[model samples]
Target: MKSTLRSELYKALTNKMLYIAIAIGLAFWAMDVMENQEKIKFFDETLQWAVNSGLPIGTGHEGYSLFFLWSGLAPQTKGANLFYTVWPVFAAMAYGWSYSDERRSGVYNQIAARTSAMRYYISKYIAVFVSGGLAVAVPVLLGLLANAMFVPYAQVVQGLGAVTNINFLSELYYTAPWAYGLIWCGVTFLCGGTAACLCFVVGTSLRYSVMVILTPYAMFVAIDALTNSLRASILKNVRLILSPLRLVWSSPGWANPEWWVFLMLALLTIFSFGIGYWQVVKHELA
Candidate 1:
């Protein structure tokens, strides 16, 4: 199991698709950074801007920490919007579709001749999960570091947490901003992993490579649309958004992002693993 996992991870991490996802995610992050040139300019000429712009010099708005990330002051940045909109594609793009190829091409038979099919499938799942998680997580971490280079970690205001749409975990954002940021990173990782796992299942049936890769993104968009429609039509009081895509955005979203998200993600991951294991080991081995 250890050897199988290590081998699969090597291929997954070194895969060109992983890098492509990272590059795409970072490009969106860069768009936000570029769009915020006015704020960056404020950093350069705070004294000059305070006089003319009429905005407070350092009221935590000019460049609060994590400003360039999806969760920062620029909640509706065009690039960030685009990035989150298609993040599931990035997740699944990493290593999710490989399983379909291996199964169809009979590579699994060769692999199973040496190691058990159970070990091979388990390793593949881990590789997909890690690569998928990294595809999204790396860009967010890099975005934070990049934003840190230009902006200071201005303490998130306690009273303004709700005002800024950080209400769900507003206390965490208010007390320890860095921890709050890390929590979002964790969220991104889990969401990405689950998205990829679901795509892996879809890949079982999809023959077209492009559609196999795109399965997760389509599902996220469809589910998010359904959730929105349901919320508007019937479940008006329920503030918790069901779509993971919506949860990826930090600000101006989820006034009550319930604790159940972690539960849902956990169950989804288990279901994917269980189904894959059952399909491969029980039926294929038989």
Candidate 2:
């Protein structure tokens, strides 16, 4: 297992696709920052006005608050939408080709001769999850760091009262800003890793690199559309479970930090891995 993991890790580190994923993430952050420059400027102006008027800067709009440094880069935010939309693709690039490339190059036969299918699959799974997670997390963290350089590092107090609609996770945003930011990064990593693994699993059969890579993104869009259509129904919870946006954004009516949300995510990850393992074991390596 160690050898397999090391080999997989070496491949991941050397993969040009990994660099492409990172580039995509950084590009999204850059675009988002550029688009939200007006908002940042307004925030600076508001702070200046507060100082001139002898009023506390905390009285300004929530949009200008320090919390925006992190929240502004969330998947649901306008500037960050590009990142959210293409994350699955980034994830797909991270691991979708792990098996397909091997199969195509006849490397799987050599690896199969040395290790059990289960060990090989498990190693690839871990590598895919870790690499994919990093691919998604790093760029968002960079964006947050960039945003923080411009915004004041103030507490998110003034924004609390405005949140008349409660999201169970809202307290963290106000009382524990760091944790809130970490949670967003964590979710991005988890979702990105899962998407990559799912694509890799699909690639076990499909073998078509493009189709495998796009599968996760297509599923994400389909789920988003379906959930939006069912917004008024009780199935909204289902929508939340399926939508990565829910993990990043504090929706008006939904109860976030809900145990069920994590539970659902965990189950999805396990199910994807389980299916991938089964596929690998049954597959006839060429």
The candidate 2 region of ten consecutive residues with least summed lDDT is: 159-168
Q: Global lDDT for candidate 2? A: 0.69
Clashes of each: 0, 0
Candidate 1 residue spans exceeding 4 A from truth: 42-74, 162-168, 255-258
TM-score of 1: 0.87
The most accurate candidate by lDDT is 1
Name the top TM-score candidate.
Answer: 1
lDDT of 2 by residue, 1-286 (tens): 8999999988876789888898988888887666556677876787788889998655554555556545433443565877776778888787666777776777877887799777888888888887887787788777877766666566665444333224535667677776777776777677678777776556556657888788777877787788767775857454234565445444423444556556756876887787777677876552
Please provide, for model 1 over 1-286, each residue's C-alpha lDDT reduced to its tens digit, 9 standing for 90 to 100: 9999999999999989999999999998887667555465656576566758886655455233443233442255677777777889999999888898788888888998899988898899989999999998888777766667655556655554432443446567666777777777877787788888876566357777678888878877888898888888788887665776665655545553436667668877987787787788888843
Cα TM-score of candidate 2: 0.85
Score each candidate by Cα lDDT: 0.73, 0.69
